[model samples]
Target: MLCLTAQSALQGRSDRSAWQYTRADTPGTGSVRWLAVTDHFHGEQVLRIHVVAGPDSPSPGFPLPRAGEVVASPAMQRLFASTPDDQLDDRFPGEVTGTIPVDLLSHPEQLIAVVGGEVPGMFTAAGIATSPDHAFFAFARIIVGIAALVLLVPVAVFVVMASRIAAAQRERRLAALRLVGATRSQTAAIAAVESGIAALAGTFAGWLAYEGLRRVLASSVTYEGFPFHAADVRAPLAALVLVPLLAVLVSVFPLRRNASKLPTAVRALPLAVGIGGLFLVTYTSAAGFDELAALFVISTVVGALVVGPWVCLQVGRLLARARSATTALAARRIEHDPKASFRAASALVFAAFAATYLSGLVSAYGDLPGTGIPPGVVTVFDGRDREIVSDGTMADEERIRTREAIASPNAIINTRREFVLRERRLWDDVESAVHFAVTIVVVVAGCGVAAGAAGGVLERRRSFALLRASGTTLGQLRRVVVLETGVPLVAMTGLGVALGVLTLVATKGPLPTPGFAAVVASGLAVALLVAATPLAVLERASGIDAIRPGTSA
Candidate 1:
């Protein structure tokens, strides 16, 4: 979905003409100003900025009038405020002289309207490229691409967690069939039927949900100061068709006959070495092997994931040695199935990893270099000057070859307001993308924890009832549950944070900054709350009937 959105943004951008004019907005209510621009185009007083499909819709509508002919709408005119007195300059709106090729002064007629000081918030199809909005499509594309990468962590976590839960559930059922003289092929067929039903049902529901999701994104998310078309947000047809097939493969592939796997400790050695290699590369100057470093990062992530189950196994064994019955009971259960024990924490662990690493990178980059310029001030420059960005500032458009730009040869050194505004918008979009990514990880993780906890409750009912029948208190049973899942969540999530901070410091050459620390801390607190979802089902799980032995649940 994210890749498709990015592609759609680029496709839309390919049709845009270079900006011909630019204007500074009033001090506040930027949404109103942008909306005013939207309305002006909608009224056909100016040409359509985006060509919408329909045989009847007018093509090449009215051209926006020049300064002398434009009748300013009072509401739209208020969207422009003159440059402030403190930062005022010769190129200040309504005061700028003969045209220059770059932003704000590129369009003569619109510049005249701005210079004359009764600015209408109107834009020609070409003039729309003049404002900070011109780069919004590119910004949106980058944001979605980053979001996809960030979100992959949570998706991978969920897949691993869900597979653990499903495996545990199926093993007991399939083990019974093995005792009944069921052939291997018969068992495989049975497993396929069970998993197939679930896959088909889930795929159908996902298809339904995607339609609503597409509508919501189309309505609420904007690029280039306008929302994208609803049709552009769809998943590929191939993806929709393949989802159930993939789900079946994930569920059925693990049902192998005579499958023998190495002990997790032995399996963990290579992963650990990969992580060690990451730390070694960090301390050494192996920067050119960034691709190898990326592989190391993957190793680190997978190692952290594997560590959760290993921790559960060790803790269970240690607890099983305890004198207290409750401790032994909790510990033995985790020991019996360590992967299932650690499943609930996987999402949260991934969240911590992502938050710590991504926030560290974001903090290191900081705001755009010239983002500090005053709101109304726009530094001028000669369009042809090759040294426009020689002072370490970002260039607006180095390839611009407009006639006005060619006529002007002088370069001014101050920061341009348009670039400042564009960078700010870019930052705003990034912040929104981060929030969206965090929410996705949290929601997916929350569901995992909730399902894992509920499944644990169901699976342990008989044991809980047996303990209670033998004088165990309800409080003690709850403690057992909490210690089993809760401790691993804290311990494993901490490991994730440790790994994340190490990766960030090693790769970026700085410790996680204070700003990133706060962000990661806040994210961890929210993710930790998912650990409590199991408490909601505790009351029903310890019923007395489960204590009556020899009868199946």
Candidate 2:
């Protein structure tokens, strides 16, 4: 969906650009000299008056809806229609009443650039239109394309979790059928049918949900300019078809169930190398973060992924030596199946990595109040217009002309308050984007945690029954679950935070550090919530019926 939305936005932008450029090349037949935009005096209110010097005959360019050959505001039309000729400006350009082609208004900046005319200082409409893709549409595509890649990680995590959960259930059912002399193909066919039905249903449901949410958003939300029509927010047909196929494949061919109970300590090697790379970049007078540095930065997170299971195994060993029986029991369980113990934490590792890195990024670059004409702000166009600054105002140059256009001092500028506005807006946008992305990742982690919790109980039902049948109480069992799972969850969260902060310091400077308290608190808050999810299914898992000797259910 994220990729689809990005595709939609990019396609919409392309269509608009092509249409605008096409109209620009149309060689419209209009003869009108645009005079200075004159402000009209209608009592107290300031009305926009677009006065053009042209004859009342049919104008050459796209004519307005009314019988005039010019494009002026309705107020101009009213004034021209009702006011006496003597009352108006003695040199009023001809009396014209018409609307400009909507396309002309849409590309104010592009048109202004082409027109080579004076830009009124009062309007910021074109100023906000930064023409992000005018020269770098490919760059825009890459940036948005990166979003698809980033989001795919979470979606992949979710699918892996779902498949792992399904695999556990399939193992029991299929193993039983095999024991009863069922052929391998028969079991595979049955598995395929089950997966196919569920995948189809789920895919359809997801599509419905996406469509409903998009419609609601389209109706309620509005854009500042270049309104992106809701119709453009469509997923490609290929994406729609791919979803079900991927889901079915994931469900039917999950990771192998018989994972060898071997300690995966070697997984930590990459983590060491990644950190070493960080050190090399940080201390070796390395210039900018090169591709090598980037690889190192990424190595830290990827290394953490496989290392988590090993960490769990070691944590289990240490817990086994603890004085508390609950801890010992939990530790033993984790030692028995460390991969299972770390499954959910895998999801969270990604979240933690993102949280810490993003936090560092925001702290480091979120604020860049310029260092220019005003001495504290970034300069606009190399600060050549220092003479324009007087008493903290752009008032010196009422008409500031640059290569771009003859813009007025009142226009949305790169100096003074406008710069301040941009700085503030940048901070806000970065903060919001980070918040949204983090929230999404956290939610994805939550899904994994929830599924892992439920799957854990179901897989270990017989053990839960045995424990309960013995002298072990449900309370102790709960403690064991929390200790075993919660330990790894906390450790993974802390590891993620540590690695994130360290990487941040290495890549970005350390002057503006990430807020340790907030980041830690938030990560722990989410970790604790995930850790508690297992307790929700404890009672049902340890039921009396699960104690039956031959029952796999």
Candidate 3:
């Protein structure tokens, strides 16, 4: 929904010119003369338009003469109303004003443009031609794209983990039914019905959650100086239907994959490593922000998918060489089911990558030169002599006039303070959004880790019971469980931080020492805590009581 809204906003801005111009006679076609005027009033910029409206005006598909009262023929008024008072008051101070017809305006010299026709193509042309506006819009589009990617990646990770949990429980139940003489088709039907019900309930809950979030964001979040209202956040009716259907499909499709085979993990490892290497190369190659950002997102996602399993397998192999019986048991369990541990910690890996990138980007921005000239200083140049002089203070009007008078202005008029200020604001907004997004991702990842750990305990209840029955103390079993969870988590967290720091260095960004340390520490602490928490709960329950003979398989 957020992605959709962002796309819509970009589209709206792109079509702004078409929304402001329309022909009167044909209503939606033909040519008409128009003028656009821009000026400053009461410290705010105002746009006013004067159109040659007659019986042959064209319709531009949206509200026109957006800020002023209308003084047009009755025919034009029938086609379009004057700008509303509230809108004018909100955007421009003072009393409401109406648009003026071309004939009604006293001075034609004030017109900024006298275009020949009501050209819908003019908006695109003007947008591209205006450098400042073009840069602003480009930055906005990139920021939106980045935000959407950040938002979706964590959600995708969470969904996959959740589906794994659901599939594991369903597979076990189906296996139990199979042992009771139920046919394959019966088992499939039962599983489908159960998944469908759960999917529906989850979909409804998600819808409610989205609505609640929309309400909060509508009140709080703004983009490009405009608030995101409820209408802006509303998803189409088709999405409402398609989303639930998609959820059901996602829930059911995994059942077809052979869980015994580790081929997917093996395949993902090469892809993840390859992508990470490619991203590092791209970042260090001085590529454009667009390309670098694309590679960064792709690498983080692929890395998250493979990092957990890879780390788990490596730790398991190392622990298998240990002499202790408990260590050997934990190592075998992790090696046998690396996927379980991966599902628990994968989200955290991605979160670490995101946090690291953002911290580096912010630090880089902070290192930019602050060479802005202080106010009240004036510099002047004498022609041909090439001598510059700095002396008295200049008023706003004098500064504007001086800029206008200079034929080839290079030094005095090219102060970078405004540009730096704009850039700072843009990055600041992006940083704030990213921070909020990362917090949400971290919280969700923590929940997933905790839940996955608990699910692992439940799935291995029979094994745990057998160990206890064989005279392994409850404390020893608990230690095994902790080792099973902790080793993989610690290893994966370190790998994640390393990848993040590599990205920072590759991008020529500062390391942000304190920030990086905090992220690493917090990530490791939260991961270990979440991973080991389930064992603490299980300490209260007797493992032997969970044993059942048929449950081993």
Q: Which candidate has the highest lDDT of all?
A: 2
Q: Global lDDT of each model?
A: 0.51, 0.56, 0.53
Stretches > 4 Å off in candidate 3: 1-5, 8-95, 98-154, 164-182, 236-308, 316-332, 347-351, 367-373, 376-415, 467-490, 512-543, 548-553
Clashes of each: 2, 10, 16
lDDT of 1: 0.51
Best by TM-score: 2
**Shift of residue 455 alpha carbon in model 2, Å:** 1.9
Worst 10 residues of 1 by lDDT: 39-48
**Model 1 / residue 299 / CA error / Å:** 4.9
Q: What pairs collide in candidate 2? A: 29-60, 29-61, 30-60, 30-61, 121-410, 121-411, 370-377, 370-378, 371-377, 371-378
> What TM-score, over all chains together, does every model reach?
0.60, 0.70, 0.64
Question: What shift in Å separates residue 200 of candidate 1 from its native position after superposition?
Answer: 5.2
Give the Cα-based TM-score of candidate 2 against the true structure: 0.70
Model 1: how far residue 327 lies from native, Å:
4.8
In terms of lDDT, the poorest run of 10 residues in model 2 is: 122-131
lDDT of 1 by residue, 1-553 (tens): 4424545534433332233222333222221111122111111122111111222312221333322233222322332244232222122222222222212221112222222222223222212332235576576567566656556555545543444443545767887898999988787778767767776787678778877787787656654334555555666566555655655566666732342332367646645766677777767766665558777777777776767777778777888888987788778777877776666566556666766676555554465554455333223344533433322322222222111222331223333544455455555555445545655666556555555665667666776777777888888887777666665665666766777877776665445557555554555456556656666666666778766764234
For model 3, residues 182-203, the per-residue Cα lDDT tens digits are: 9987876675576577667876
